[model samples]
Target: MRLSVWRIKYTQRSCSFLRSFHRSFAAAAAAGDDGKGCGPGVSLSDLRRAPACSGPLPALKPTDSHTVLIRTDLLRPGKAPEPHPSPDQLQDRWDDTHVKLPCSEHNLFPTDRTTDQRPSKALSVFLQGLQGSEAQHMFGELLSAMAQLALRAPRLLTQPIPLLRTQRCRSITLSQEQVSCLLANAFFCTFPQRNSHQTEFSNYPDINFSRLFEGSSQTKQEKLKTLLCYFRRVTQQRPTGLITYTRQCLQRLPSWSSSEKQFGKLHISCEGSIEDQGYGMLQVDFANRFVGGGVTGSGLVQEEIRFLINPELIVARLFTEALNDNECLIVTGAEQFSRYSGYSDSFRWEGDHDDQTPRDEWQRRCTEIVAIDALHYSQFLEQFRPENMSRELNKAFCGFVRPGVQPENLSAVATGNWGCGAFGGDKRLKAVLQMMAAAEAERDLMYFTFGDADLVKDCVHVSRLFLVGSVFRLLLQYYECVCKKTTRSRPQKTLYSFLSELL
Candidate 1:
């Protein structure tokens, strides 16, 4: 069966279940107060860039011990490729912990019944698009450029990529050309051990492109077009900057009960998106613990959409492990290559995007992305537990806090209703949690409600009226009151209503 068919069925069933769950909560709250009371004058415009924060970008040099650089020579512009290494030297570049390259002699591409040792149908179609005068006009001899890309793969990928193992901080930095080459190999379905059901790298997300080509939905077709467009553009003129993926792990969780941080400046809006309006700021990825969350399959949400447009972010799945409670992945310098519209079931690729974001001093794009997965609750009330709330607070702080950087040097965080959709999170509760995290991290925040007018008003009002500690205490009290109720006859107050009535 086609993956999209299964996805549609699964989504329908999920929506049915969610509707029932929502009705239960509604019934419980039917007799409660509306909680529409507003605090002293606060409007959306007043929050826009109020007390903006800016500072020098942190110095980001590649460290030898914890960092791996694929194609080190490519770091400098106009530098020629290094001489091809001997077999022994090549062996030194690989290890059991790193990605096993498809071009390696022991791990060459396998012959299949369909293509018979040639490129697969998907790759053939992509390459065929590079032919003829029209293709030449747009991509500037892309066929030849692809041939050169193939020639440079083995040489450029001499170093083994280290897996960003849990509890260890490590980084992988590669040039744009190197990223393109690796993705080309992935497009050809050349990564070994990635497609098998039981493999040594089962813990990692799938890096091969086989599943992407199997779905029969329009989502798959449009996704392929977007990826092909990325290849065509990059082959036309290779990007010159570097992109870094850093896995950060926090050793100590914050004491939320005693922390005295106040709410930071917030810019709330019902317009624009994180990618469009939050440019140059640290953007949040509402991720799955597995990372890249179903982009390889039919799952299309915030993380998948972001990966489809900027595709370089997808490459992180090659080495990144599943995120832990106190860990997050930070990606710097990925350039957006495609424009897209709608979302999930209604998603459509809207052709090319010319990324004009400036590069930093380290020759990386100024765009920064942080991937943090929120806890998935089976029951809606489960998230209100004190432990789960603390877990989420730490997870957000793990992504937001800049350990080595000074408070004034942190960039404003760009985020929205993170984990509120499929994960069944409450928008008002999550907004307050993120606000507290950003405040503790000493960074300003830009909250995009994605056209939720009520959320904008509620967040603005509450933020204006309370400090971080006050909100934290109130949430604890609210959770206790809700969880202790034993009778269905009693009316239940929502978190926002509880906060409103008291404060």
Candidate 2:
């Protein structure tokens, strides 16, 4: 009798949730359906760039490389789209603008092939592997879609260019169509060569979709399903909303020797992910030196999973230099399109996520994240060196500081156990390092332990000690002692222990 009652209640709750979802879905469909020029096809030909012409423009000429246009109406109901320009003709080049049209082809595309234009031999292996698979047809269609969209407006790929000729940070707002176009390039492995073990491209993060097409594992299939889901959603609805990408860099490194005790606010939570809880604030990605790290290679961790869901972030590697220990990368306005459960090897894409976060003045979602790479200690005891700790403090400081922004308006950093899992960093030490850096930067922090109860208690106790008067001064002095080899004992100690003794 009790089981029957429970079943009835569960069914009612499920039905209620589904009804609410249906209402929201219907409202979206209705809003998009209204004939206020919100049709499926965009005005491509009419979007031509204003001419510097005296009379009339010449018609586009046929090129050696064929032009492929993929239309939504052209897709057969049950069959996959046909492939275009055989993989052999791809003849990949780094600087060779992937989109080649008659008018813009010669003017926009670089004529002299430089060293950067050298082709990737590894790409040939991956491309050939996709010969008869479902991925091949899908990839060809995506590439065609990208080419067709870019031909409409050249600025989509040209402006806010990926080279980063200037060192200054830039923030660009892109429509969902623009994002799809960029992601389609990624899907086709059009980016420069990225080999994990090769030293030439080691500094830059892996940005291509090669890995997904390289392996035949179950994981590859699962990842492909999630990616296809995103493609279908964007292609079908054509989101009008905008997303921003802000590239933040620290031009001036903070001084570690300063004893100024500026106390920033902090929040410690035992459960939740940095992405889920840190939606509006600047979330931290325990990243690799090469931004996206092994996300496109063989990696699957906090950083990689973050990239998989917000794939637009992977584009940063094109412009960002390899991160030094004293540097960090901040990305703003990336929308989370999918959600997954589990961490690392256990990660599984659950489904689509509705990013309800409000937009900023720039029409981007108010989501910001900083990618900071912590030092990976191969040996357990190597991280204790005072110099290493100092390096971490500087790295965190670079990430926390919001340039030119007023102190009161700053968003608190959302982070926790940054390098504990993959990098073998001591969790307590990392927490302390982040707190100190935040204090120096005059920003608050929200630390997520991801369901570690013991850490919850430890954080509370340690943070209390950290907030006390003279804690900063004493900590610096202790660091000096360790560096000078002047400590009373050679025994290993927790940061809390050293602070407790001082107290």
For candidate 2, the 10 contiguous residues with the lowest summed lDDT are 45-54
TM-score for each candidate, following the candidate numbering: 0.81, 0.67
TM-score of 2: 0.67
lDDT of 2 by residue, 1-503 (tens): 95467446544554543444355335434544442112311122211111111123123222232122222233332232222222223222234223221223333323322211321333344335554764565457754564564343343443323332224454444455556666665665544344344534544555556665665554555565566557656665655444444455566765554444544555677777888866656788888878888766667788888887887677676556677665667776677889888776677879898877765533446677788889998865566665687788888888888666556666667888988986888887788788788877777677888778766656644544333123433454455445245443333665566655544
**Residue 13 deviation, candidate 1, in Å?**
46
Best by TM-score: 1
Candidate 1 residue lDDT tens string, 1-503: 55467446544554443444345335324423433123212233333221244355445444763554544434454332232232236643345678777777766436633212233454445435555775555345554666567556766766667788888888887777778888877776667777765767777888777777663666766677777778888887767777889999999877776566767767788889999888878899999888899887788889999998999998998888889999999998899999999899888889899887776655777888999999876677778888899999999999999887777656778899999998988888899999999988887788999989988877866665555555665677677566556244222777778776763
Best by lDDT: 1
Model 1 Cα shift for residue 274 (angstroms): 0.3
Query: Which residue runs of candidate 1 sit more than 4 Å off their true CA positions?
Result: 1-65, 68-94, 108-151, 486-491
> lDDT for each of the candidates?
0.74, 0.58
Candidate 2 Cα RMSD (Å): 19.0
